[model samples]
Target: MVFFFLSGKFDQLQHAEPLSAIKTAFNQYFFNISKSDDERINTTRSSILETAGDCIRVLTACFPGLEKIIGSHCTNPTKVGPKETQHRFEYAFRSMVKAIATPSNPVVLFLDDLHWADAYSLHLLTVLATDAYSLHLLTVLATDREIKNFLFIGCLR
Candidate 1:
């Protein structure tokens, strides 16, 4: 399997290259392979929360009102019940749909800590990735674990 690892501090994502890389991937999938089943996944851990926050800020600037919607629920990163996390992610996914539907420009949703994410978060991510083309969305995920479990296992199956 092909795996990409994003390590180090969260602030590093503020640098243009990482964000640009994400944008490039979105463009590639959206424009070049409209009908093809190409899947792009991002994996990160809790260490990059600040970076993920920065990425979301950039996305908000691109798509106004998105920050308010997603920022409200994505506030704290504590461990929570599966149902609660799923609800939060559903809210987040709705925000993403709004942003994508309203704007001419593309939007990227960066999930920065897959390794630490709860089951609901992972389930939402899986749903998003599986339906990315229909939704017109780009998801960037980050994780630290080598062995795939939980969400990763679901992704495999």
Candidate 2:
């Protein structure tokens, strides 16, 4: 989704790397208390949670997992256009989020520093935000007001 817009073409994909300046502070407080699920998922989510080691395990585990499946288009990927990958990324992200969320526990999906996020990421956010009612999601997006305005303007077109 990430691209260098030196020209008017979609250029580079977002590198599958660790997010160093990670974690977003929420304005709305989340109560971590939830009913216990009858079936617990065996996810290593606790390791890369918004803790001191958040970005550490993400590089080796989380981001790679996302990149592997969602970023699977390898045949002249740059020339394939944005629509192709946006749906795939959104589906993968939604599935992952849904799998981790339960009635007892809600999912807090936060994307920070969105000014640097790729087009696909932005597109995914637009999709998720539009369909927020269907999912048990608390989506928090962070960016400068100017960038938000720009995104809004671009989205309208």
Candidate 3:
């Protein structure tokens, strides 16, 4: 899920004169760039790295940090094995719980190319739907095929 504080809080800042306010907003909300040591050059490389880190954090929360397992065990069954998939599902449950418990900020999770997800991922999505209402969270799952499973279909009901 993605959270947006009221737009009004940011709109004025974004449109302020001299663009200093906008720059400040970007710096504070997005990144903690060095203020004293360097010229303020907008670096796309740094921005990309920062965003990737944020994405990793969200994913780690979602699956209780299973990316490491996937990386470590792509070839070694003893290391990652089928249990890694189950751990990912558990992580999703934890993510939902954490988001719901936070209470203040809305959480947004984006699951892209869900068609590539394994059975455990689908199971996690099912569990998420059940606990979804308790959290101020939004999950976006993108897939090429129509998902017709009962767990998903029932969520819309």
Candidate 4:
């Protein structure tokens, strides 16, 4: 099994960026899988790029500059309602992650210090958590010892 350590902790010196953990995770997946000459990795890499690009184009607000990372153009697509677009974004990301994980090679995403994650990041995490039951994927989340907002905890449940 392959493990991808995705940290949600923001640098204290810099401002918290939206989708930083997601971007970092995708970037790691993009580069790491691209290095292999194996046919399965090649196919998985292409799947990740295509699905992630489609979703990122729709979700540029949450993932600024992400299209460039995936080598996609920042073209304006036909606008859909925000809620519909968000659903598409979440579904696409779920598909991308599923493409990487197989019975022989499961993927683990370790997200640390999730309390510092932005609202959009938390929403995406919740979506992934809800879908994890069906995928060969495991998500490990860590937060500070003291959670200031019980509402945030409630929402994640």
Q: Report the C-alpha lDDT of model 3 over 1-157, residue by residue, as the tens digit.
A: 3252211011222222222222232233233222322432233223222333323333333332233222222221234456664564355335433432244545445544343444444555566567645366555665555644333343334
Q: Which of the numbered candidates is closest to the native, going by highest TM-score?
A: 4
Q: How high is each candidate's TM-score? A: 0.36, 0.43, 0.36, 0.71
Candidate 3 lDDT at 139 equals 56
Quote model 4's TM-score: 0.71
lDDT of 2 by residue, 1-157 (tens): 2111110111124313222212111111111111223222123243123221212222223344422222323232233346644454445444544534545456655555555555545555566567644266666655666543354345434
lDDT of 4 by residue, 1-157 (tens): 4555443443323225766766766666555655655775656646556656556556444444333334445565567999887788787677766766666667777766666677777777778778854377777777777756332475467
RMSD to the hidden true structure, all candidates: 13.7, 12.6, 14.9, 3.9
lDDT by residue (109-139, candidate 1, tens digit) is 5655444455444554566566544354555
**Superior by TM-score: candidate 3 or candidate 4:** 4
Reference-based lDDT, residue 110, model 3: 56
Look at candidate 3 and give me any clashing residue pairs: 1-107, 1-108, 1-109, 2-108, 62-91
Ten-residue segment with the worst summed lDDT in candidate 3?
6-15
- Report the number of clashing residue pairs per model: 7, 0, 5, 0
Ranking, lDDT, top scorer first: 4, 1, 3, 2
TM-score of 1: 0.36
